[model samples]
Target: MAKAKSLKAGDKVEWETSQGKTTGTVKKKLTSPTKIKSHKVAATKENPEYLVETEKSKKLAAHKPDALKKK
Candidate 1:
């Protein structure tokens, strides 16, 4: 399999949603379990998730690194 994308904060990325694909900039890299809004984010140091702000709505959401494609 190909290597997973290494994303960092401020990186422009895109991910798929129910509406379609959306673009965003990475706000932070979650390296530990944390809560955002009411959702429990189960991120870890080895396997991390990104907090991103959507381009259109500017809403924050957590996404797996694999789910994001660098732009």
Candidate 2:
């Protein structure tokens, strides 16, 4: 598997979802994996995480660093 990403709050990012390409802001960084929309996220202290809220939908989610791109 590829390495996870490191992100900070207030970062702009893009991600692919059922709704298509979506943009959002990083809300929080998680040290451990958490459940978002029934999906299990694998997060660790070394890799860390970012909890993002979708710009259009206003939905909150957790995503791996590799799953997101800085924009």
Candidate 3:
């Protein structure tokens, strides 16, 4: 299995997209239930999620640590 990435705010990361891979910067770590982009996120301290902003579009999205690769 692939190792889980330890990401932090301001860290550069990349994830898969329909167009291909997109790069972004981590905005924050979500450790509690919250809503993002009108979608409900079920993140917890033990299973946290990350909020990232795309470099090109500057769009915000949430993703799991395993889904992100440090750039």
Candidate 4:
């Protein structure tokens, strides 16, 4: 696999979903464990997750760096 891209807030990114590909904007980088609603974000400084907001639904989600493609 390719090296994961570095991301920050306001960066555009995309990821796959059951509904197919979805696009969103990075809201924040999670360096420690956190929660999104009832879902626990198992994040770490070495393996962080990104909080993103969907362009359409505006729903919030957390995804690992490798799981997101920076655009």
lDDT tens per residue, model 1, 1-71: 22226777898888889999999999999999999899999999998999999999999999998888888
lDDT of 4: 0.90
Better candidate by TM-score, 2 or 4? 4
Candidate 2 clash total? 0
Q: Give the candidate order by descending TM-score.
A: 4, 1, 3, 2
lDDT of 2 by residue, 1-71 (tens): 22336667898889888868889999989988788879887888887778999998889988878888888
Instruction: Give lDDT tens digits, candidate 3, residues 1-71.
Output: 23337788998888888999999999999999999878999999999999999999999998999888887
What is the TM-score of candidate 1? 0.90
Query: What 10-residue stretch in candidate 2 is worst by lDDT?
Result: 1-10
Give the poorly placed runs of model 4, Cα more than 4 Å off. 1-4
Highest lDDT model number: 4
Comparing 3 with 4 on lDDT, the higher-scoring candidate is 4
Best by TM-score: 4
Each candidate structure's TM-score, on Cα atoms with residue i matched to residue i, is 0.90, 0.74, 0.90, 0.91
Error of 4 at 16 (Å): 0.5
Error (Å) of candidate 4 at residue 53 is 0.4
